[model samples]
Target: MALLLKEFSPAELDRIIEMAWEDRTPFEAIRHQFGLTEESVKATMKAQLKFSSYKRWRQRVEHCRTKHLKKRDDSITRFRCSRQRAISGNRISKR
Candidate 1:
């Protein structure tokens, strides 16, 4: 996992964490963007978050239909909100 940590910059990791926490961002999306599998993302979240928070996150994600591509609706193609502010040069701006 240290090797995986080395692969991402602090900003990238932050982005990954943010994405992981989003209800619509599936594990496959994280895998596609960062090469981290669902398990890896879970591990990273566990390592980064407090134990209770991690437990709550796990409970929330465990059965969330939107967190897995296979379980998500076919019509949903994008993970982010259409009204979401743009991200530029690693900085996410509010609308």
Candidate 2:
């Protein structure tokens, strides 16, 4: 697992974890952004997080339609909320 994570910086790993926890961010998005497959993401999560937290995350994602591209509705294209402001300097603005 260390070998798998060696490529990512701490900030990038944190971002990946943040993306993984989001309900609407699909594994495909993570893959596209980080080049980590679904299994790799799962493994990373398992390695980095507490066992309980990992289990909870696994349970949450197990059957979630929004976490898988094929399971998501075609009409729902964007993952981020329309009202959400972009992050700048690691701070998300309230617009």
Candidate 3:
């Protein structure tokens, strides 16, 4: 899993970390975009973020109702924010 994560550029890694922190983005979306499982994402977060930050993120995720599709409200749909540009080839477009 470390090797797989190492394959990504710094920009991609940043985006993965960003997505993981977003309340509206589910683990499935990260998996779809980065081919990382939830555990893999957790590992990445733990390795990349400071210990305190990682613990905070874990606690937030545990309580974030929108982080999992099953736990999210049905009215909410989509992964990215409505105004965000489309991501292509794992790159987020700049406005």
Tens digits of per-residue lDDT, candidate 2, 1-95, equal 98989998899899889989988889988888788999999999999999999999999999789999889999988876676667543446676
Candidate 2 residue-wise lDDT at 79: 76
Backbone atom clashes (below 3 Å) for every candidate: 0, 0, 0
* Superposition error at 5 for model 1 (Å): 1.7
- In candidate 1 the C-alpha lDDT for residue 62 amounts to 87
List where candidate 1 sits over 4 angstroms from the true fold: 86-95
lDDT of 1 by residue, 1-95 (tens): 78778888888998988988999888987887778899999999998789999999999998789999888999998877887877554468866
What is the overall TM-score of model 1 with all chains considered together? 0.84
Pairs in steric clash, model 2: none
Once model 2 is optimally superposed onto the true structure by TM-score, how far is the C-alpha of residue 77 displaced, in angstroms? 1.2
Full ranking by TM-score: 3, 2, 1
Instruction: List the lowest-lDDT window of 10 residues for candidate 1.
Output: 86-95
What lDDT is reached at residue 83 by model 3?
76
Tell me which of candidates 1 and 2 scores higher on lDDT: 2
TM-score of each: 0.84, 0.85, 0.88
Best by TM-score: 3
